[model samples]
Target: MKTLSEDLMLLIEREISGQASPEELVTLNNWLSADKKNIKEYQVLQQLYRGHQTLLRNNIVNTDEAWQKVSNKIEILQNSNKKTIIYRWYYVLSAAAAIFIIVFFAWVFRINNQVVTIEAVAGNEQFLLPDSSSVSLKKGSAITYNRSFKKGRSVIVKGIAYFDVKHIVSNSFTVITNNTLIQDIGTSFLVNNTITKDEITVFSGEIKCINLSTKAVINNIIAGKKIINYSKGFVVTDFTDTNILSWKSGVLDFPDVSLTRVLEDISLHYGITVKCLPIDLSNNIYVKLHFENQPIQEVLNEIKLVTKLQLRKGNNEFIFFQSVKNESSQIKKQK
Candidate 1:
């Protein structure tokens, strides 16, 4: 009897689960064709996997009932005194136990390798990781980790998120985004990943940022520092955006900021599009405002009052224009 190696067992399990890659399938085929015993081993494992699936679907919760059923089948097989029949049954029963062990460990391996994804679809979302670290994702942001997250503290992030990482000296927290890896050195940080660039800001403690593509160490960003990584290179600078976490905080602060910049922030926070018709109005006007958890309509109304710009709403979009009265007055002045 040829014994199956752990690698061969895994390959058979992947084939049984229909998860084997093309190369893996070719390898399994070659092994199966090599010998008759290998084919028998594969058959036994396939039967085990199918039996497990059936047990799951049937909700076989009582272990004693299952064992009794197996014992009854064994007694029936024992009654067959023919030498060949008895030998085949004995081989099957013995292989069944070994196959069950392989299946059990394979199931555990799948569970440990499972991927967990968290997304903020309609609104901002907050979640606590396995290690009790907290993450706040902006609208349209998402993060993914493995089921064994505590053992290996790594997450892939998309869009923007704020992470208040729980520090473990032995295992460092790592955030991967847009071909860049940001490893926490006991830090609370914000990462903004866009199509064009990635922005990382360390709020407390420090972080080591690296470019995954080039395998280059970007910088060790300390608290109150930021790294903006572009396609060409990266720049480390002083962090200045206080409202960077406004989506998570539910506060939008614009202190003497241009109307254009404020509208851009508003669009991002509300997950909408804002357009100024003339475009000049956005550039010329400056806003000094603070809002906390206000409705989009209320915020736009307030902006209309201050900037005196006409507002129009469309599907997932808002347009601002100079009021007809203001346009007429300006025309008269020009004439």
Candidate 2:
């Protein structure tokens, strides 16, 4: 059997429901004449529609109410028919049944597939899933799962998130980002999805990563390991940074790291831009610091004391620059 496009399916539905325009009717008629297969497909859909109505009428306890709703719609269609051309009453009844059954099943499908989206308006938005798995979304990050998530544990992540999945026997938890799939083997993991690449850091247990486009298994990322997936390929590496979860943990630790790298982490943690004037100044400086649940200003003050760089704040941004006094002192020394 040939697969039908949604447009063709909708067209068939409109025709069956007696809602097709004259132009649409002509197009549908042409399609039907084009192939015997089209006729068979249409017949199959009609049978399914009628079969569902029969099953509902026979099996449902509220049969009267259900029948009444369909009858009312049939009456409305009949009354609204102003054309003088008389048709068989059975044909009109069939049309009404087709409309109700098609619409009813469509509504049921939509309800079953309804998506629930959770977004982190602020950083460190933590919540539990229906399966009792915990999720921590970074600010501006969002995750979507079907309403029936417990039946199938899967979510699509946008931006960055941390997952502590609750394992259930005979069931699997999976995270999807970009075109990659990360199937958790009872694990806690962090996923960072950017435009050009996706980074997965497994904290505990293991996860099987796959490239959805190529259907190739990338690697089984074990605990304390990470994987960077680019469009062309992927690379698996050890976790070099211990403070990767700083955003969720509310701890920013820079252990003897260069000033430039520290500023990058600070910017990401605070969701702001950090710039250093005379960029080379930041490159030459290094600092060791630890902050837990401290305000950005306090962190900046500590950095200012350690590196002795002037700090300035603007809208959603921070600047570290060489102080004018220090610049003048340097000029005098050079002279």
Candidate 3:
């Protein structure tokens, strides 16, 4: 079977972080209700994470220390050997199906209750619905679907979400934002609605992108490619990082695009500003740059070394500008 959706991962993260929505909270409760073992497992996981919080808070542990504690817990559970060991089946056999039901029930009850403001905060944030579709928002990202979401498969997100959607018989799964609706025929994707244009890149399968900013939708997008959105709607734009699969793989792929554009993408990915100042002389030149799974600093250095661009820090942003030599070269060529 396909692995758990990014939405599920986000849900798990939200729950652990305690950033669950009312619907999500109910979903968690419902899951706890479904199987006695689920509650037990949740309790175990909770206690384990509590140790993580304590150690980190006390400064007795660093990032590695926090993660190692969790890892140790996992290793302890796994080494117990579910099939052969008496307690093995509980952790070894796993309860993926049963856990899924927990998400389903929580969503159902929350929807029926007409929840208006189910916001996710920072930890273990997840929501389960009756349809077996789950959404886990990223930190600081918020999502809102109609309380009638179960009746009509639609959601509005303002940050990022990983969706684990159960297949519908014939309809496509849609995540609605302000200007367009991202439609997937049941695939996993990470959506950053925080973009000025609100973009969605499909990690797997196909997504039908439609812009609804006008009275009627005036644009369309396909999977494996990204649609750059303008203020009012979507315009066909190049996906510099078409190969980046935030799902399945954590790789961020940047393909052949403009340097200026690439900087914008990097800024979005890292939540920082990388802009060029006094950009000129070589405005229209397109470079084939690839930043495959590299650190931002490394990527930045690569860009600087390759393009010989000048950079300065201004207003919390790395301002980019062309060197004076490039301008002189243009002047000499004109003569």
Ranking by lDDT: 1, 2, 3
Better model by TM-score: candidate 1 vs candidate 3: 1
lDDT tens digits by residue: candidate 3, 20-123: 54344434444443455764455444444444445446654344654454455456665555555555445433443444454344334333434334566643
Candidate 3 deviant stretches above 4 angstroms: 1-139, 145-154, 162-164, 170-174, 179-184, 188-252, 281-295, 322-335
**How big is the positional error of residue 264 in model 2, measured in Å on the Cα after superposition?**
0.5
Residue 288, model 3: lDDT of 57
Clashes of each: 0, 0, 21
**lDDT for 224 (candidate 3):** 58
The number of the candidate with the highest lDDT is 1
lDDT per residue as tens, model 1, 1-335: 66779998898776555465545544665565456586556655655555566556665444466456556666777667688667867766875676567556554443433557799998889989999999999888899775556755767788999999999987778786655677788899999998678999899999887664444675568999989877566789998876778888899998887788888888878878987878776887777889999998899999888877788887778999987668854321111
TM-score: which is higher, 2 or 3? 2
Per-prediction TM-score: 0.65, 0.70, 0.45
Question: Residues 1-335, candidate 2, lDDT per residue (tens digit)?
Answer: 88878898888666554455434544554565456587556656644544455555665335466568656755665555545224435555776677677656654443433457899985569999999999999889999775556655667788999999998756777776655778788899999998678899999988987664444576568998899887667789999886788888999887777788888888878877987878777777777889999998888898888777788877777898887778754311111
lDDT (Cα, 0-100) at 175 in candidate 3: 68
Off by over 4 Å in 2: 1-114, 313-316, 324-335
